[model samples]
Target: MAPVSLKKLVKRYGALEVVHGIDLEVKDREFVALVGPSGCGKSTTLRMIAGLEDVSGGTIEIGDNVVNDLPPRARNISMVFQSYALYPHMTVGENMGFSLKIAGRPPEEIKEKVADAAAILDLTHLLERRPSQLSGGQRQRVAMGRAIVRRPDVFLFDEPLSNLDAKLRTQVRTEIKKLHARMQATMIYVTHDQVEAMTLSDRIVIMRDGHIEQVGTPEEVFNRPLTKFVAGFIGSPPMNMDDVTVADGKLVFASGATLPIPPKFRQSLTSGQKLTFGLRPDDFFPTGHGLNSGDAEAVAELELPVSITEPLGNETLVFVGFNGRDWVSRMLNPRPLPSGQSIKMSFDLSQAHLFDLTTGKSLVA
Candidate 1:
């Protein structure tokens, strides 16, 4: 029952407060990711949880006890940093067993623990190799092996895969996921990559300006973002957004382009209200290439000119001219379209999002 609970957590230096009073709960053996752009205080928050940074306000509980006053070692947590932080001179086995050695554990116990972790991480064959002898991915496995030997209640990972190349990152990401399944430890990962957060975490905590924007499962956050920022930030290629004014039950773009207000938002909207219209590339597609198969009544069709096309293997990204700007649409089973050619484009209004322009909040419900 090693659940982690943060109650009104805060971090400050002098008069400058960085992490605001944020509350979060990570269930036992649950993987949670803290993700946001740089300077969002995600790493700071993780450090505070690991006791590497002093808490300025409120309590942090690991399991059933408050750990604010505990030191990093006493808190019984293992952290794997972005920089492998391995001993250059020590062999893989030595590096993994160093913590236990320093703690005055029996030599045989240390050896057994290191061997078990090495086997789990597929490092048994490389136990004799030093950090310099290992590849980037192998070195990362050693880092994870070191953390695994500790057998802590919680595992803290601070952008551990950022240093690796894309291919290596993917490999290590899968390894980390498998490690979590085998260990069932309460792991808290901090990364700026939303893809990593989406693929690795059971739930995601999206942060902005030192504050938590939203916390939800990947599917929840993707299909139903609570705020405009969440909708725009969580998706790759991002959601297309444009400012509009409500007029005669229509959303009128600044360039005089008008679209019928999404049916679901009709009751919540008022004429003359300003809004930010959002539609993902998947929802706005070249007709016959979209993913949606239901509710044609809310779909809007237009003969829009194609501005550009990016062919990506199984699908293509088509940028169409709309509302004085280029709106991207995803095309499946793609066909080559010459630039500037007029094509029938579909906007699945059933999946469109409307946000308050001033507040940047979702208008549905």
Candidate 2:
């Protein structure tokens, strides 16, 4: 953040090249999330930005200054790590004031800064407690306090809530988002969780195989993914993907099921052209005299024997298999679904996605 720019960035270890050339311009005060699967270079990229790792190629500029050789502290950035990186022996006050003390700030100034950050993060009450006495959320807050007291031009978060329980993670996610709004400071967060990326990011750089798959707002990446990988990776429950072929001007799945192609899509595909069909489970629903009913062509019914039924308080997720592939359907209303019952399911092709089989690129632009 603070307008970080990576011009043709690359990372290499001897003969192994992990990150190819990547050019990105991160605007000042923007909260951008770099998200991808493991080994996809998201962490490596963040480390490089933090000056924790060396860039094998290209230039990294932080606020108009090229910081290619600067150390982490010299880069004027504070990072909240996944491990919390808090000293167990230090009290919260000491932990939060450590950075200021290291910078040779006067004791009174350090004390005032720690107090201010503690108040901001609601950690003032726990200022005298050791990390050993704190809960996971409290410890994480102390780490954030440690980072915020520096008042760095930019902040880096490397999955800081990964260690927390589900409820805590959710709470911290909201807190982090609100804190960003409050601070109005530049930030770059890295995570593999799609929900984390979608909820927290102002803009996301979707990464794959050391390359950027797509970079856009969450809605853009979810509603109109540029690549097959982005479409599959960025959705909860994931988008359903299956081999498909154009037959008789219809979208034909490999299992012999057929769905009607949208008018624009039907005109684009060549008959017999091999493709892949993708759709989020939430995009499909029982046909009613409503929004997507008439638009869905060739409603192929599936007599699916339910394999698993997960009924939460507000919704039900039914797991069913079809032709060696698992299909999940999310029902908003809570309904008891008995296993082995033949459930009728349909595909809504109007909102479906078509990918080129060879290139894994979206066919319907």
Candidate 3:
């Protein structure tokens, strides 16, 4: 396995720069995921590493050697794409061993490698079946098996499970994780799905506008987002960001409501500070320890009208309007609640996040 590094990498088309001076390091045997919305240059970065795209600047290093001038065949990297790209007419075993055969390896060597990959991917029994005879998940495994047979220094996965159904995608995710564990190979994966990134990555690179927003573990990104975009984007149901201002050394939202700020945040506040207050839905509870007690710092309470309720089997998702903005909160064992009715909601003050209204930087120290 090899450690991959990109130094000040830049990609451009004519005069328009898409990827602007991005640097990344994937340690040997590390599973790193590049996650973001479309057009964030993640796919471009992966393609550049695969030698499929021309890099406008910087160098790509596999181990200690610079591979900027290398071709796809010389890069010693294997890529499993969103589409499995399996040959439809070929049997699973044939498809898996095709690369080896084309390279004129001995028949015995090809058979041994193919058998090993099939066992690793649990496709031993399905080796003789054609692509049309296999399920989506099976085809994905075959694509991965093809990559594994080559034993490339680095494995690049580009949303390999996106084509599968929801249940199949979940199943395949576990399988892929197990494969990585057993192989302990260097991997760099790209996806727009946050759930995939959260579950699969040891470290996730969050990108926006061709720039890295944050790079951290799933828990760090979820529990302690550094930017307003990250705070709102990485979570399910998204974080509620209320436009607030510093009033009398306290954070006040719309409807003349006040929530106390930790002293650590006060140092970064503007004179007539306009900020965005962030609260994750998971942090709010139907019942909390403390309610609003003006001068003393405590959990802030706000009354909001229930706008909609979505029952999600295990839990109910309740949507409400507060401070002229909509917020979604997850509730356990939630019975159906009528819309247009008012209910009191309390937020955990200790779990709150604050961001600069203009700069979008976090106010938390």
List where candidate 1 sits over 4 angstroms from the true fold: none
Flag regions of model 3 displaced more than 4 Å.
Answer: 262-271, 288-297
Task: Give the Cα-based TM-score of candidate 3 against the true structure.
Answer: 0.93
**Candidate 1 has what TM-score?**
0.98
Q: On a 0 to 100 scale, what is the lDDT of residue 198 in model 2?
A: 97
lDDT of each: 0.94, 0.85, 0.85
> Candidate 1 overall Cα lDDT vs. reference?
0.94
Order of models, best TM-score first = 1, 2, 3
Clashes of each: 0, 0, 0
What local lDDT does model 1 show for residue 186?
97
- Regarding TM-score, does 2 or 3 come out ahead? 2
Task: Give per-model TM-scores.
Answer: 0.98, 0.94, 0.93
Whole-model lDDT, model 2: 0.85
